[model samples]
Target: MTQTCLVTGGAGFIGCAISDALTAAFDTVVAVDNLHPQIHKTGARPAALNERVELIVADVTEPGTWDEVLAKHRPDTVIHLAAETGTGQSLTEATRHAQVNVVGTTRMLDALAARGIVPQRIVLSSSRAVYGEGEWLDAQGKGHYPGQRSAQMLEQGQWDFPGLRSQPFRCAHTKPAPTSVYGATKLAQEHILSAWCLAFGTGLNILRLQNVYGPGQSLTNPYTGIVSLFARMAKAGKSIPLYEDGHMLRDFVFIDDVAAAIVAAATSDKSGILADIGTGDSLSIAQLASVIGDIYQAPPPHVTGQFRNGDVRHAACDVSATRDTLGWTPQVDAATGARRLCEWIDQRPEQLERL
Candidate 1:
């Protein structure tokens, strides 16, 4: 008998990519998404999946919605990707983020429990924001800075505590310090998954993805992924807006690579494990803008405004654990991915306005 896989938020960017990959391997793929107009307001629904995949439109937070789908499908694997995901927005709409990210995840786990089916695996799409601003430690490990930023620190890639020598920069792993409501809720969800595994013996795989980018990304939301926003601006012949000095660094992982990692995690025997999914490389906002400009044969982005609240200067994943556990690594570099995205935009001028 072939196995069944269910992917929540399957209509969204990353979720859609994972659903397409799962449909190719699993006998059945059930994609559930609320089709929340807030995240992806307009665009043609995501394509590139086999006929075996079934699309279910429902909010994951509602208990009644998943009960039928779960009972009918009884999926062997559940990849939960549904959530309200924006750090800045989450700061203002804390309640909504908590309702969707934390409450929705709890409901999904509850649905699985009600069916008396402990799925072979449950894969969660998490985020690096759980680390918050990331801890800064000195060489002696005695000094620590939680949320302080300095110009000298950025230049040297080292943060200095008042009384200690500067040390290699490190994000705090001691305790989760979520900077935004979204990050806090994601951390809560991760802990909840861990608790479920310990209490019920369910297998769980948590993947904290970095800045994921590629085609099919909705560009209407400027508050979300930067790559999509930049692509949209370039296509429109408008200068890309730099949020800061364009020095903010981010780990940009291609969508295909992210999908491959999710597939690997679902197939692996690993359980109750949290791993970072990224290319292990950092790119500045300016660098990213230049690459996109090159791809579209357009002028460089015009620096516009300064960084706003809840924005971190830099954040990148280690990816060592991901490599060891999933046996997967990013295949597409930033340049290649940017070019591919530009090509897609060029081919679909009509879709630009919809985004």
Candidate 2:
């Protein structure tokens, strides 16, 4: 018997890798992507996409987008990775985020139910933004999940928790508080899929990924990943701008590790499992800038004291449970991952031209 897997956003950075990984496990891999101009400058199939996979160019948010694909393919597994993913941009483009992330998910669910085509399992590429400020510890060592930072607080250049300290985020421990519009929409997708999957007895795996970066990431898309942005600036001999006094913490996971984790979740027998995919550690933004600067031999990064609205002060996940459940662990450290990313960017001069 032949099994097929359908991946939304399959031609993308993480998607392309997953599509390649799926070739060994599934008989057919079908990738549906809109090829948005921001991510795909040519608005065509990316060269990095695996040649063996079938590519379908379509927007997931559009009505009837999945009708023909669903009827024809009837995929056994579905990896939902299609969504708008700009945290800062989400503030100004709330409708676009909701339409694609929240409503777009519902559209897929509706189509599946209407057609009576229930995939055996569905995997969602969720974001850590749902943890909003994530887990914080007070003076007494108690955990607290704080709300979004106030405008006045940011203006005053206060970046940390008011009276508490941040702690490493554990997927099962951290509460979903979602500060950004993008985060809210992603949480909505998780909730929507959870209910639908439960009702239909479909397996579900929700992997809340940390800052995913590596080769094949969009160097042209300003909102894609901070690593790519910094690499571009450094390659251009420009000073990289460090925000919020450069103390903001993030867990930058390599793209290959993320793709492997997603593949494990899709292939594993586990159902109703929610886990965090990361390096299980974090680094300050300033440290990250220094690493990139050293790699490119560019000017030192300048700490701007600037803060973006909807940005979290600290975010790093405890991936212990993810390892136990998905049988996966991050293989690349931050420094090595950054170096690989810079090397890839260095080779692609055409991408830097659009910067």
Which candidate comes out best when scored by lDDT?
Answer: 2
Tens digit per residue, CA lDDT, model 2, 1-355: 9999999989999998777789889999999899999889888788888888999899898766888678678888999999999899999999999999988898888988988988999999999999899778888988887789999999999888778988877877788999999999999999999999999989999999999999988877888789888888887888889998998889999999999999999999888889999999899988998899988788999988888999999999889988888899999999999999999988988767766
Screening candidate 1 with a backbone cut-off below 3 angstroms (N, C-alpha, C), the clashing residue pairs are 135-172
Q: Pick the TM-score winner.
A: 2
- Model 2 TM-score is 0.98
- At residue 162, candidate 2 shows an lDDT of 77
* TM-score to native of every candidate shown: 0.88, 0.98
Worst 10 residues of 2 by lDDT: 62-71
Residue-by-residue lDDT tens digits, candidate 1, 159-253:
32344332222222434567677888999988998888678777899888888888867656666878877877776667777866777778898
Judged by lDDT against the true structure, how good is candidate 2? 0.90
lDDT of every predicted structure (CA atoms): 0.77, 0.90
